[model samples]
Target: MLDVLPIFSGDDRITRLFTLVPGSDFEADALSAIDALGGHTVPWSEACDGTYDLVVAASPKGDLSQLRGPHVLLPHGAGFNKSIPHEGSADSASGLDPAYLRRIGHDDTPIALHALAHPHQVARLAATDPPAARHAKVIGDLTLERVLTSAPLRDRYRASLGTGARKLLALVSTWGPESLIQQHPGLPAQLAAQLAHDEYQLALVVHPNERSLLGTYELTERLAPALDAGMILPDSHEEWASVLIAADALITDHGSAALYYCAAQDRPIVSVHRGGGELIPDSPMAVLLGRIPQLGRAEDVAETLRAYRPGAGHAAAQAAFAPPGDAVDRLRTEIYALLGLTPPAHDVAARPLPLPAPAMRVPAAFDVHVETTAAGFRITRHPAGKALPGHHLAVEHGAADEQLARSAGLLYRRPLPASAAPVDLAWTADGWTRHALSAYPGCRSAAALLPSGECLLRVRGHERMYAVQTEPRPERGQVVRIDPAVALSAVHARLLSPQPAPESRTMLNCLIGERTFRIVLRPATDTEATHVI
Candidate 1:
């Protein structure tokens, strides 16, 4: 029996495959997915330490070296377009060379299984000279299979959107500076104005990255005009799928939204683009743009909608990319074959996987008491306090090591000053690092001043430190209290001077809520101060 570990990277669309692994009889655990997203599952370090026979990843990137067995890469979304140009294609303008793409965690990691979404992707990989191409195999689109098989779930989603008798239109967005929403900021409200509210219902699903940058509350407020016009914004991946199923027509910038919606629902599509040119030449977006009506202005959306019909691109999309109906079974077969074992006899019913819970933003109320010890300062949490499980206690001090919170909330060592420069006792979760901070709001900022009067900044709740300074330095022994509530809101900081001097060491001001704090810095000097406060 092979022990399989399915690694999920917070993309809820990818985690949909977890629903199919129940009856496989392979000792499979979803520790990686839980780690990538927020959940109280097995820790990633424990899951990766030779505990499983095989590791399956949703995307082609990630650190899979810890596994002693072969790893499998599954397509997280519609992999119809080649992310990088073909091996020697003269498209250097896209900056997608094989080497650069591979280094950035593209699907070209050797010694791994590359499961293609369709035969077209297999052919595309075969044409490349990369070693990853040799491991590529067609496994079909598992997400599409999940969407198509679940009728009741989809209906519930549609009903929740109030799609009673009106046609639904989903406007999907992607990341990057050149993404659809970035290119046309006014597209959502513009499209809403063109469609009749009584006859048509509009739904918006912005990329999770974009949503994170602007924040859910901020994004919703930004799109209040559309929401007031009866346009629904699906907050979760499940709701997004419901909008896709209910949508009679789809309008998207050249992202996976075009391919997945068009292929799965056979819906008519309108591809939007900036007037300059296509983002990716000869991509699936280009193909869809050529087949469907391309819009450059919001004024043209209504006209294009009138001319387009449902399932107009079904035949062409199906012919170009054949998405299999039995993708889940195909994936299971591939897994068994790779392990040289017979397929287990089981009826794996298509069940709905739980949607990920939204991240918490405000710091939880905790009863923290500080005590001084010989080694350092010790902080303890009262038994009656409440916090999200798996949160590690991180101090704002630059030299402090993160301590995991025990059931009794006995966090050992490092006491910060109660009136010190906004020393934050942050509750950080696993996988809430600098790179992945946009997804979680709870651990966005954790900054504090050390005993030496040097400022230590932790952005997105990660341990990466930056030395910042403010003009008019605080007295060496004065208890300068930087408000934790205010200092955590600074988005970015830069040292204005190369050298840290009393006169020149000033930091660009950061916003703490409505207030701005100008921090000053001095070179990190040795200090023997025992207690901070």
Candidate 2:
């Protein structure tokens, strides 16, 4: 509905905007969004008493016979891939379900037009309910096209999401008992616990129906753990389109998001809850699911995420839509014709998705395990909120273990204040000893990670603390990337080793995730380390 608002933005003579409340199962949900759009909402009883040029609605549920007007039925999702399981008189195609379309005793569809997004829907409608098909028109998918149009702003979305250079794995679930969120409630946090937050980003895309069904307060509380472990949830349903645009891959169920994202992105999808196939068997989604991979609770998330690719059948996914990038133009033409007016002379193009403003909470504490290997350094980090076991605890300022006594832990600076000097970004471990020891009982090492790919380290047992920062000199033609926390953990492993490396050697290798960095080590005094270590 938000997608089509711009078409009516300039129409002055259309006068009052009155939304008919036809009592859908998700009526309040629709009304809330309509309320956001700002309009006078009229209930069905009152709506039938008045006449208008045209009326539009997304859901076909409930009795809309009392709503008198030339009705335009819009696809709330990607051409209804699900069956109307509970629409009485046995299940039927969701969008063209006949029983919900006509007046209680009448045979004809009250809707003047059934605006579909694909040719396939028109054909399906014709086969299942010829009356609805007579009014169905393929106008392309306005939402999907808008997402496709926003491709050029992918980086912008990534920035807004704060995912940085990491591959974003989006967990998209629709509302229902069979949805992924309902089946595996902890998957988001569990999947995130497998990899360091710095190496990969995870987010949950929930259907508005579920959010409305459970109510925002309850749904947010349900996602508390995932949110605390750095997973983001959009502020509103409309922001989800941009989330799809920013995703590198998808972990989806049998929802419309899976269908639309498959069409817009070439990235692979790992289907969760595939067993409950309530899918329209011949629908594009069902066909795509047959070719895509399914994930079980026992499957290795990291391995699947890194290895799977949406190989082949991309054309099949695209065929579900009525061409791309021109939905706004096509939809506007159909709607204007219904309003008995010319679609303003100017050309129409699908606009970029709205900027996503999501509440993203990062892990405040981590249980880090660092090992010295011949390959370099192997580092693993898990959030403290999870039940996973860790040998060492690394806590931040406001983390759960922030006040816990740590005999041997690594302590680092928190995010710098706005007034902090640029040099404050990196400070040596020795000078930080006072702050670290006071903060953590057995603080052995401290580090200040820098934005310029440098880490200033101070190991207490070493002779004099160094004030110099270490810079990487990648092995010939190779680029060095550093995950600061991982880098600090690697340095901790290096310092606490059974047989430490010879201090005389100034150069060493450190590995984090799959990337290796060649760092130069040096010996410096605390005063010299004040600027950087």
Candidate 3:
């Protein structure tokens, strides 16, 4: 039997690619739809141990050099197209680090199976990186294929969102500091307010990174007006896909969401500018954006929505990336060829797998147990204990010296246990911390007590854990207590610095027992204050 491991990092789009192939085991960033796909989930480190027949990754960042077997590069989206400015230009090529390009380029690269979206991408890779071109095979867009083939699923999704008898418009959000929503924070509500509720419904599908950076409460608050206006928020990739299919028109920033939606549904799209007036020069997103109607101001969104036309630039976008709906079959054939196995008979009648539940913020990798005690809480790790043949353990957080057991579970005791002492925690704009914490004796979990008296518990690699305050007061330099409870494992906080350095900045004032701990906030020098959050 062929052992294939689909490795997914933080990108949820990569997870969608897994839905195209059933029965393939996955090593994802967390417990995700992969679990529903009937494959056991393993850590990326374990998956990279090179035991599988093949490893498939969406991004080029992972350490594939250690792989004992061949690995494939399944891009997260369509590759850069000709319309993308400077993509094939020698000037752009000259600007890139040759060493970095060589590492990711075709020649002497680790990628054994590189899947391209179209012939244009293949040709570009050949000219830019010949080795990559030699290994490249055009598989088109798998996500678009899922959208095109799964009509019944789309109907169910629309019904689930209660979007009936109403023209739906999807406002898709992307990550990055200067994303569309970031550029226009009130765009969703502004647009929703302009449209007549009886005629059209609005839905917001935010990129996962936005939630990570802003925290759930802040993001919810930012979009509160829209949600109150009956704008549907589809939290999972499956739901988002359905929203795209159900939407008559799409409003997006400079992200692949617009491109994917347009290519798959052939719907009209309204692109919003990112950062300054200029889009990312020579990018596919910029190229696609140029072809469609755009809105620079929130006030103009209403007019754009009313005048939008479906099938605008759909044929050209489809030709550039989404070639045919047989991408899944083509990918399977490639996988079989790579593994030296015969392709299974195609099942034309097989309906696409039902979309799994929306992905959760904290992936279900290990069972996290929180035991509240007088001194604080005891956080323990209980492995699923399933027999994952040829798998290992890799922890994304915590002390580097701390060892992960391949078979045994870990017990995190409060008060700093000598065996697992010296836990380090770092906070950033992104919700999750960099390292995991191993409980020691007297080592209680730290929390950021919101001004509303609601406690936000700390999870090692998550930023979405928080109790909603009935009345929220969002302000700058508002002193909030930081509580250290035994029940909490890690404290997740987002620090927003919109201006340059002052001498002293107070992040949060924590009141624990009789003492108060003042946390200091500082940003790296020379970077813009806006860049911090």
lDDT of each: 0.48, 0.68, 0.49
Show where candidate 3 strays beyond 4 Å.
1-39, 81-101, 104-110, 152-156, 274-283, 309-311, 346-533
Which candidate tops lDDT? 2
Clashing pairs in 1: 8-33, 420-481, 421-482, 422-482, 469-519, 469-520, 469-521, 470-519, 470-520
lDDT of 2 by residue, 119-218 (tens): 8788877877776678888877777777778878988988888876677888888878778889878888677666576676777888887888888889
Better of 1 and 3 by TM-score: 3
lDDT of 1 at 300: 76
| TM-score ranking, best first | 2, 3, 1
For model 3, how does the per-residue alpha-carbon lDDT over 25-127 read when each residue is reduced to its tens digit?
2323124545655655555455444355565655443344544456677666443421223333333322121232344433333567777677766776677
Clashes of 3: 24
Better of 2 and 3 by lDDT: 2
Cα misplacement distance, residue 450 of candidate 3 (Å):
44
Query: What would the per-residue lDDT of candidate 1 be over residues 101-173, giving only the tens digit for each residue?
Result: 2532333323456676667666655555355567777766666665566544654555556664456777888
Evaluated at residue 301, the lDDT of candidate 2 is 70
